[model samples]
Target: MSTNATTAQSPFDPDKSRIGRVLCFAAHPDDIDFGAAGTVAAWTAAGVEVSYCIMTDGDAGGFDPEQRDEIVRLRSEEQRRAAALVGVTDIHYLHERDGYLEPTHEVIRQVVRLIRQLRPDVVLAMHPERNWNRIQKSHPDHLAVGEAVTRAVYPALENPFAYPELAAAGLEAYKLPWLWLFAGPEERENHFVDVTAQVDRKLAAIHIHVSQHPDVEAMERTVRGLMGQTAERAGLPAGRSAEAFHVVTVNGPGTIAGF
Candidate 1:
């Protein structure tokens, strides 16, 4: 593995950055932990504020249908604990029932409000586009939430006139500069954040989601392997680990963006 991102560049693309506030939206409680918690830890360590805005309680994630209410409470607590491990205390759980999310105007309105209120420099969300390689796990809820978040970030949140009600309520439009999409198709310009130092924190966070992953040790190993694979693809050393993201310039010039 090598660490020569500059040498292989074709043109200017979004680069890996850790700055300001970052708002992450996920379909379920464990989605961010499973996909980008290491990167989140790394960002927080850099003094960046991170918030988790989850769409569902993940009550339908488990098979034990009889314990729905209990599972909901347990999962929410677990997610909070997991997020706190990485210095993330702002966790918003949207009460949409699991497995029934739709990319409707209502969903976009919900996320747009958060986007305007939080006013984050960067937004992290699941990829709205389906990845052919991850066909099996591209759940409908994930797709819907992803689409909603994406819609909110663009013309919806940035356009002051798009939602007069939010503006009337003192939630000003926020022109988000960058966005990072996880679990999506990989490209040459994608950013791979080296999270070698935060792997322990990330694994610990994942461990706290006990309801989702009961075998902590197995989850740790799997996470390490996945991050290591990302590092290898980014041309890093064998022992190094990374969290991958496909970042894009949203409302700003790609070349001039600070990130």
Candidate 2:
């Protein structure tokens, strides 16, 4: 497989892999846009189908208490608009409470069902482990989502008997081959996508989350700076941008029956 010039040997490359579909899981509406919208845009531009599975509506978000009752609807709408900007329209909302997500059995089963139904070639999710250097990225909801999706991608989704009701409903067991964990600690990052060309697209998508950002311009600058730093670390050319990830080969050559 094509590997980055700066990264170590790997089995798959985002540019060369026959990745047809990608399913992304996030704790809130804006999470995906913040973490991986540039990569999503690149994939869609390459003719891959991308979908978002938001675990929460971000009901507890927004700066004003007066908007609490309307936050859910507002955030959901914003996410749809943001996704559309990056060529994604398929979205699944689990409606799990914001600020209180957990890797419960029901949540795992829900994720498993989606995996079976969509049968995506790759799944991108938040990092389950906390990043001590960047504590904000390790939101409780994000960690829960990562763990839940990780569980679903393993024996649960591939085992016919794990969630029998899903099979009864015609969603058969699926073997997801690859997973990408975002917002992880620096040392664990094994993949970096040079997103310089798609940075504008990513910024446009992030701008859609107006309710979540009090200063859009400042947020854009910060995101750009972060991406630039990531690119530098990945040995990309100066002025380039990138999004990093910890890739796991779920059902690939190295793994043994999804172990």
Candidate 3:
């Protein structure tokens, strides 16, 4: 995690011609919808093939205790619906238990397999660094997923010798060029996507997770305020909304040209 990213750093610029595929990894079902659905919508609109890999089925989420038994199925369906709204349909569920995720070798291998199978140019994941300012974003599950995926993206993905079983299974080693991390410390953010045009779709996606939000209206307001703040920090014009990320070029610099 201490790789000096000076040469690997860049802003948000997924040129459609160069960036063909993206793989988004999240700890739970609604994580992507809340953090990067708008940016995902924008990417899909530009014909980028985007896929999701949710580490957990969000069994520990939701406000109701009565539906605990069915939470897994409920959240899966909700996540699929939400992802569809933003033009994504291929979602891989690892089915890991929620609330107790860890950055173990098995999880990292699963992620590496998906990255090889997808061969995505960019992989969007949760930030590994704890967000001290936003305690909720630093959920244990989120941190674990971030660390696991980061490990998968680094030496594991590119080094053909790291995981022999994967290669034996025909999932050849692939190198990911870019990594974008969200829900991280604001000071670490180096990229901003102006998602003003896709805010409605983002909110709609979030609303699809009915079990998670008891007060949808309040959640929408809070999300708007947060996105607005990001827009202001990105120096976007007033009335604009944006999503922020800490971009990391995993392979080398000059892979993605910033806008």
Error of 3 at 81 (Å): 0.6
Q: After superposition, how far is residue 214 of candidate 1 from its true place, in Å?
A: 4.8
Question: Mind giving the per-residue lDDT tens digits that candidate 2 earns over 1-259?
Answer: 2223245344566456678899999999999999999889988887889999999989989998889889999999999999999999999999999999999999999999988889999999999989998898999999999999998888899989998999999999888889999998888888888888898999999999999898878998999999999999998999999998888888876667635
Cα deviation in Å at residue 63, candidate 3?
A: 1.3
lDDT of 1 by residue, 114-220 (tens): 88888887899988877776564368888887788888887788778887898999998888877878877655227777788888898888888777765667878
- The true-versus-predicted C-alpha distance at residue 225 of model 3, in Å, is 0.2
Residue-pair clashes, model 3 = 0
Give per-residue lDDT, candidate 1, residue 251: 62
lDDT of 1: 0.79
Query: Each candidate: what lDDT?
Result: 0.79, 0.89, 0.87
Which ten residues in a row are the worst by lDDT in model 1? 1-10
- As a whole number from 0 to 100, the lDDT of residue 63 in candidate 2 is 96
lDDT of 3 at 89: 99
lDDT for model 3: 0.87
What TM-score does each of the candidates earn? 0.88, 0.95, 0.92
In model 1, pairs of residues that clash are 2-235
